[model samples]
Target: MTETTHNTVTDERADLLETLAKHRQFLRFTTQDLTDEQAGQRTTASELCLGGLIKHVTSTERNWANFIEKGTSVMPDFASMTEEDFARRADDFRMLPGDTLEAVLAEYAEVARRTDELVAALPDFNASHPLPKAPWFEPGARWSARRVLLHIIAETAQHAGHADIIRESLDGQKSMG
Candidate 1:
């Protein structure tokens, strides 16, 4: 390949890594102020907590990676789940019973690592992958793996914003980076 192409690739990779890093920064910022109970507390009538958001984001990363990017789905076990399921399960977002806060944090850290690995390993940002035929997304829309990564970033960002708000409401603190 030409030197120009190599430079372009490097630049692209840098931007992707930077974007992912920012997401991690926010995730850390959001959870940093919370105590164990606060982190797991449901802030609103709707089931949303800092811990829940963290769990949701991790699950989403793995879901997108496995079902969309890697083409090996694990949705069947969760196929019966719906929006309500999420709302109810939000309270259970923390690590299983007897699990420590460190364990949950480690799990999320691994999720972020896997996300980074997927992004870094993609040689071509333009390559397409099958997206679920969900109503919210365009029908039969084949998304580039790059787009999927970006979408995850965007979704996490939105939730991070919510987490920041909820965290502040729980206490006087605000701004998740």
Candidate 2:
């Protein structure tokens, strides 16, 4: 069993995972009681929707987890990406046809499960990997496993806030409340 000291790597990992779990629940709470059609509705002027945000976070976290396990992340080829490809990619955050709330949530749950297992099995939190080449990322930047986990927690919290707003706008329900 892992030790549970406040500043230990095990403690930090446990805290991050707990925060991720809470925020993930907040995200799911936002979609609670909403029909699939309502979930896809754009309550705000922004393109983001509750279901889509959930889907996006799930995809983003899975990619980051994979990056941590391996040395690099698998990304789509933007150079070869046609306009059609880009448009289709946009569907990640938009509840398109055939995208149901249950299906998306199930997929997100599976991703989270895999991520948790990977984090638990990590040999060292300080282990580092060079980030993949991407214009959005700083050049030659690398992140330790601990940092990557923190990044995932941050991403989840930020998206949870976005989801809270969208959820509040819909039927005047707040996730926090």
Q: Which candidate's TM-score is highest?
A: 2
**Candidate 2 residue pairs in clash (backbone atoms < 3 Å):** none
TM accuracy, model 2? 0.89
lDDT of 2 by residue, 1-177 (tens): 543333344766778788889988988899999899999999999999999999999988988888888777464544567889988878889998999999999999999999987787777777898877666778889999889988989999899999999988888898865
Error of 2 at 6 (Å): 19
Q: Candidate 2: which stretches are off by over 4 Å?
A: 1-9, 77-83
Q: Candidate 1 residues 1-177, lDDT tens each?
A: 321253343566668768877876776687774577777776667557777677778777778766545552443334456988766665445434564555566777898887777666666667776555555656657777667778778877887788788777787577633
The backbone clash count of each candidate, in order, is 0, 0
Q: What is the lDDT of candidate 2?
A: 0.85
Clashing pairs in 1: none
Candidate 1 residue 32 Cα shift, in angstroms, is 1.1
The TM-scores, one per candidate, come to 0.78, 0.89
Q: lDDT of each model, Cα atoms only? A: 0.68, 0.85
